[model samples]
Target: MSSGTSNGEHRYVIIGNGIAGTTAAEHIRKADGAASIKLLTNEPHPLYNRIALPPFLKQKIARQKVTIHNEAWHAERNIDLMLEQTAVRVDPLAREVYLASGATLPYDTLLIATGGRANPLPNANGLQNVFNFQTLDDSLAILAQIERSESAVVIGGSYISYELTEAFRSRGLQTTWLMRGPRFLRRVLEAEGGALVDRIAGRHGVQVIHGVEIAEVRGQDGKVSEVVTSDGRVFPCQLLGVGVGITRNVDFLAGSGIETSSAVLTDQCLRSNVPGVFAAGDSAEYYDPYVGHPILMGTWDNATNHGKIVAQNMLGGEVPYDDVPTYSTTLFHNRIMAFGATPESNPDVEAVMWLDEASESYRRLFFQGERMVGGVIIGQRKGFPKLIDLIKQRTPIPVAEREQVLAQSVQ
Candidate 1:
């Protein structure tokens, strides 16, 4: 039947209870006090900080520190929290959402913040040791295995895989990191930065294997023991972590009217082509005015902004979503941050590099003609704020003055 709320203060149904969905629910309540708001999530937990998950996975922090909102928090707000349920399909014409349990939920407004799912090995079957480090349960399970395991094979060279590689090596496990590319984050990291990452990984006890893909996952006693590469190299391991990235959680909207380009396509206002339908979080490719293009960014800051913008638009307010995307994390005893464009986005941008001793620390700033378009800062962040402002303001720096700018930036 149609359970869209008969009391009639306009029902809002949100899918996925991550940062984006939960934040949207909060803003919706603040905007309309009496509106019926219900949140549905496939995860049992209400809301937890996924950004801090790396440390949690490494067992550096207690599990309780990762959880932000609990069951009681949702109860006090009078928001219907449907846990362990997923949206199987969406009927835009009927304004109804169907769950796998065969229940139907009608809504006056719908937000598809389903985000993405962990992409796994192509031929991975029912195996006990292969794991993807995304959710809390996945992290907990990996930690438990880490406590007993002595060797780990991490596949994929993205940030997720590196985090796993760091954790395994830090815990004194014999770790081997495999990647399909010659370098980690090549699209984002400059050649020097990429080389630095390889150097750092090697120095930290991780055997960094480049330009290889796993062709087979062989197991003994139903647990993964070795992976054979496409080139016919076999690596033995007691545990495996795959970080091939995420598959956008938009497959359910295939027949729906919502347009999707790698993710749900939206304008600067976070509005989909279908009226009363909106998308946020990792699945929303909304316009980013700061970058002068429509881009999809999966970051804590991006999702947080999307929630506030969609909430305002859903309440009949006109506002534009603008942000300069950046991601910061510590890697192998070095602190690094990347802002603005990557090679995939701005391949031809001119660069200015400033390197420190041991080739271990440096910052590379990218520019398009006169305007700053991108940057990568390592081992130093005192100059990041000014550099980011230059990007936002489209400030032009003379070619001759670029070197002096970096020199004075740290001073």
Candidate 2:
């Protein structure tokens, strides 16, 4: 952590050094140059893109390519950055934060952007060769294991699992994907989308096991060898990758007056229930103007947007963030994009789809009567902008024109 003397002057303290906190620091510096600004983070390195870690693992990209900013960039702006320092507790009433090192720092305004941690496997300690993909450290650790092993078993069916499986396959490792659900990406993608992904993974020689759970991971000499499933099945692998899910990093704010349910509740302006306290990124559950309720979006885009909004609000500007939620992920040769709420989340919706199983191209437009509610596009990224516009504008595309619109060039 960088050393800085605390003064009695008004100060802004931001926790979490991801995109949210970094962007907030920049915006605050721009709006109020003289305001004392200090940023604390648990990570040792400068802010980097967590989304690009998969490509980095596959050797398609370098670590330097994923960094958002360098140390010199933050230093030039006069932003105090405290790296590898964890905020253990928050005294909202006292307007101070207690670090793990026993240092108490005061703040006139606070931004909580701690994000989320990778969910652990149930009875993880009893299991051997279990792993999770979340931070840079985790990615590096998994990459090391991949380099040393030939066969791997992945437990989970989310996008992270899909990406990691592809990475393993690209490196010539025999990969097995074990899922408890019937399909991959069950939470984000519809049945058709999940099937398309499964087909793509299968084409790449990935063994996918559906409706199965790993009961125990058997290993020898502190290394994994085989996994026993609940269905009386045994799969042998040298490595295990677990992508169960994520839980928001809000445990530190347990007794703080800030309101939280699932995540720290914030208004459209990114301000918490407690004045002068703001939240952004995965740790913040904010009300979306489109959805009309507090929703948790753990996307990088949402984190950046929240940082900008919270910075403006902290500087006495009344800027409310009402952005159309969007998220995308790439696996092997397939590109998937989703916008707004999923169809499962909004049951009062109908879909207009254009599917060509032969070409492996699919597009589904979600609607609530005449208004477009959301959309999912697989194998075609060009369709994202137009679909996003349609959802944002609430534009109605006639059932007959759905195919024509999707075929037309977005450019």
lDDT of 1 by residue, 1-411 (tens): 123566758889999899899999989888888888889999989999998888887778888999999999888888899999989999989999999999999898899998889998777777888999889999888888998798999999788898889888887899999999878886666677778888888988889988899899999989988889889989888899999989889999998888998899999988899988899989898876645666777778878878888888877777887667787888879877878775545576777887775646778877766777777777868778888888788787888877777776666
lDDT of 2 by residue, 51-130 (tens): 89989989899988888788898899999999999999999888889999999988888899999998888755554456
**What is the TM-score of candidate 2?**
0.92
TM-scores for candidates 1 onward, in order = 0.94, 0.92
Candidate lDDT scores, in order, read 0.84, 0.81
Error of 1 at 21 (Å): 0.6
lDDT of 1 at 234: 91
On the 0 to 100 scale, the lDDT of residue 405 in model 2 is 65
